[model samples]
Target: MFFIYRLFLIILLLFTAVTTVFSQGTTKEEKRTLKKARKFLANEKYQLAQANYLKLLTLNSKDVVYNFEGGLSYYFADFEQAKSVPLFESALENSKEDTIPELCYYLARAYHINGDFEKSKEAFTHFKPFIKTSTKSGQELMKQSDYYININDNGKKQLANKNENTIIKNLGTSINSTYGEYAPVMKKNEQVLLFTSRRENGTSKKVDTDLLPYEDIYVAKQVNDNWQLITDKVELEKYIPKDLNTKKHDAGVIYSSDGNTLYTYKNDLIWKSILENGKWSNLVELDKNINSSQYNIPSVNLSKDGNTIYFTTTRKDGFGGKDIYKSSKNEEGKWNVAENLGDKINTKFDEDAPFISDDGKTIYFSSKGHDGIGGYDIYKSELTDNGWGKAENMGIPINSALDDIYLIVDEKEKNGFFASNRDGGIGGIDIYSLCINCPTKIINTINGLLVDNIETPIDGTLTTQLLSSNNPAETTQSKAGKFSFVTATTGKHQITVEAQ
Candidate 1:
């Protein structure tokens, strides 16, 4: 919490707040460069800041403050371990707070990001005894690190997808690259696939320090069960001239179930774009009721009915970093104030990339706070009258030792998709297809919008039903008046809606 508050305000406060504490000898020129770099970080200009940090390191490679801040810029911006690891290592070597709580925690985390699980484990375990009694949040991070290291050791055994009974397939070259491509969402007809990518798309003019550009929204269509990338036209990929891309992070997109209104994420902000006459409209930020650009709204998902929006936000009032929150769109077209999903769904660490399946009974999300294998493992929680049931880690093939997030299950429930940076061919984060059970079930799908008798938009106020002995095999709630459900192959499925 303080990191977000302090990091963003580094420019105005660093000289007074941190520079004096660590008096690393520096020349006047280096000090000036340090000030400039911190200012770049303040404005979210990461690339320039990284370059300045490189210059500062030339002056003082072991300067803890400079190394830490430089590593932070790389960590937060492009996520390049190559750049962040050494800097963080230097910071740790020069840090006096190794025995202290937060300082060592970051160093351990940096090691985790670098895929050095053994080193990460050593760092965390070295300070484990001290960390547990320090602070609640520090204790939480320490506990999570143990699980991360264990996953690293045991992750290779997961073969749920390799057996003849189950299958796992990467979305392949068209949809992936040496860069990251993640957060897959499909329209009702399965005609379009919208995913986020950070590859060189010949669109964005700006690239962060690691030479990778910002995340951009991209669209691909299915052709014979494969995604076809139309290299000629990138729907909303333009980054120059400050149009849709805004020269910043814009990814994590989902649709209105009808596949018209587009929802996007840019770190802390949530924006919507509508398809007007087959062209996307300008991005419009969600009302302040749901967004406070000051807080982070990293990932978002909507129920099939489009009545409610589930998002992970670092709102100040939350239990920790990024908590899942939801808001309903009333009949009057006004969004109700957002509400946190409570302690069960959130933790002392970050929780993000919430995906509520077709029937609304299942919710798949990613969390660093949960007792998952590592980093951010995708977990599933079911909603009952009592509230969300205890979240169960998806386990094995669905998760890995590295980060896995942004899980979305289709209405059919037989096949699903999730994003993972697991050790695989495609670089960064790639989307993977998961066949639910060993022998797949026949998935007769039904999805559409929900509305009141007057045809006015309805959200959480209305509930839909799919009648059968195995009723509502997969259910998704309504977000802003859209809903979806899937049933069986041989059985008849009837759609019923009632006001709550």
Candidate 2:
């Protein structure tokens, strides 16, 4: 009875994304199981995906689609690629029955990564023949990937050996799920983390792009060093409203240094949320000149000083798919119209997800236009006296054959996080932290609630003065009536709160 009831509920959710389009000869149970599995796969939740697929395989071990998708789920999860190799081989054997070119490709890539050179060569030989031929002799695929097979094979080797000094680890189930998580921004002293997800937290009832739920912001509080493990069927603790989230895509890019302002994505327009008296406000559309409403404004980052914003947009008049732009606050503390970062940073292909360093001189972002190993690779550039300098790929181990984006780092460049769907992760687009052996910043997390006499959150500015260091920090006001300060310097500190 319980299983039946659960299936009934899932079927309703499945209807939001999946149609009843089972191939003839499949039973009702098979259809349900397959849809559930596919939904999990689409959401990039590998554990559930692999589990559901294994259930379906019980009915038929050699089901080509099942094997292919199962292999994909495992391969993408990265945590289970060794076990998935056989699944890929199985998919390859039945590839003719199901049209899975990627089966051969992934199998070849897996063997290559595992150092099975002979087997990898054989697989790669088979994989390359499937590449679509070009009408003009040399022009095929992207010019950068003219030797896609060879370059990918070499790039895999580079990824295998590089970055041995950098320790990268998964954030576990608390902040990440089988669903996608990206664009991580942590609060003061890393006490809390905010990012975007397509998990069940979304209010939208429909499935996007066959498997994606509407993107929504998810917050996870860190208990010690780990995120709280999410229990099944329980409501997620952190979220925004339907107005800010909507049925369309939304994501968070950065939180102000003071920890009171959240810069986020709503309907592809960048919006900032103020936190005051423990409440978050509705996202007001930012400057019309920057948002443009006619174009998409996806990713954004704020300066350490909070006076400038670096963002990405796809305007009709843009160089291409997307371009990085910047807007500086005027003397009156309002944003001026955004200006493109220029040809040095923008390119013919897509460039987005800009992360400006604390000094505002170093910039990190992902771009396909810049020469890369494959797909989207994280790149870095410096703001020089002349202009934004030419971008360079972060290279091999840090990048992969697939999309790698939203790379962010801490003040010391010693530790931070980024989102990637790279093979061998626990799920689709998981968040991974990178530690580069830099000295850890010893810091304190200072928090307080600012409310008027009525105890309601009111517009205010909170400043902390470090007497020893002769330094000062300011915070933004949100409806939540709260303020926070993260400081590394040790000194007697005095606090002040003023309301307009």
Candidate 3:
């Protein structure tokens, strides 16, 4: 009996020692989890980190760090409504005096994100001085608060003004509101409009989640002046690799005249897609001759023949911001080296949204670099034998103080269309039309070296007739024996040269 009692005592002592060690290990794990949660929050992974922090809170209910981190996580996750009144309130209620200012700052941010402007202002007012004199983050928070206050005041006025008829309509319940819709490209027919949107129920929605709304290219046909959806929405996310599928932002697209070729801008690279058998093929990145790792291609325009490409980039040695550049296709069907349009066309400010005329003789673009009414204005320059001539403003009725972009012209119809966010539109931005009013007056001049068919120099009299249809408007003879005519309206005119 003595031996058995001694053995039992030894077993009891060993069990007690093991329990103590396990309890100590549990304490160490809680500490480690708390530290890791804080690190994740700092890196902006609020959701994952917040879950861990909340678990820690259950184990240690009075922990101030858990309350603070949980509130921040909710705020970053955009669940500001849930966080603002509860998580923030709890943190402020329990925070020590030394942490009051930080707690108040976070509470204000939560309120701000929740759209509770008045409450946010009150909290910021109390927290500003402490942040200014204390931490670096505090200083930044104060600056940010001041910026938000100003933005709020200005944004209200801007929003109110934007409701006027002069503003573009919000595309209403049909084309927008359900999703993020932007980057519209309209054909000259105006019957078909192509745009990009992040809408639901798209193919590859899972993969597209990395880009949110899964920004896809959508086409809508105009029926009775209203846009009607057609074709299955296409998401470019599948073309992207898993490692490059960013949850951030991507998308800007332009198509060739025939719509057989497509150029897309995503993740700082330019990709090309070919239309085959009525379907778009897999996208391939453009050759290095046109694309660079230094900067991204934001916009692009292709000439009528598809042999010339104009694009915008912020590569080094550029004028400023993003500059317009041109590259031509060689005989091998590869892009030649890119060439800047030079200082005449580019300025120390941003110049983008380039469109070459169908005739390929005139180029239209928007620029903040040139002296403008305000923001960006549309400008055009004709291609001369010596290169591009001086740019000319399209003038007041066409240009505005607000952003004007995506200029298009139909040479055959002599009509132009451009997008603007100016004082008149459906909302955001609206397309406008401008007519080319051809002049009526005609001028004729005849000047050329007088040479016979046999290449012999001879004195000659050149007679030119300015004709429209069957009737001749004017008949003129060249005094210097050379021929040239300038007609107000474009038409077939007859000319006759006789040597004397």
TM-score of 2: 0.64
Scored by Cα lDDT, where does model 3 land? 0.59
Give the Cα lDDT of each candidate: 0.67, 0.67, 0.59
lDDT of 1 by residue, 120-209 (tens): 777767645554335555555555656656654543334232243444556756687767788887766756777778778535688865
Q: What is the C-alpha RMSD of each candidate to the true structure, in Å?
A: 17.3, 15.8, 26.7
Report the Cα lDDT for residue 331, model 3.
93
lDDT of 2 by residue, 1-500 (tens): 00000000111111113222223228898889888998998776778998898898778777777776777776666343555777778766755543445466667656644435456657767655454444332233223223445545556565656665555655655567767788887766756667888877576878776456878766676664546632322333233332455677777747788777766777667777776765666667788867876787778888999999888887666798788888999999899988888888888888878898999889999887666655677889998899889987777557766667888888876678888766545456788777765355676777777888888766455656677663434333332466666556676778777676
Ranking by TM-score: 2, 1, 3
TM-score of 1: 0.59
Candidate 3, residues 111-187, lDDT tens digits: the string is 65443556666787776665433555545555766755553343233434331212112233345433345556655
lDDT rank order = 1, 2, 3
Error of 3 at 143 (Å): 21
> Model 1, which residues run further than 4 Å from truth?
1-166, 209-211, 234-243, 440-500
After TM-score superposition, what is the CA distance of residue 136 in candidate 1 from its true location, in Å? 15
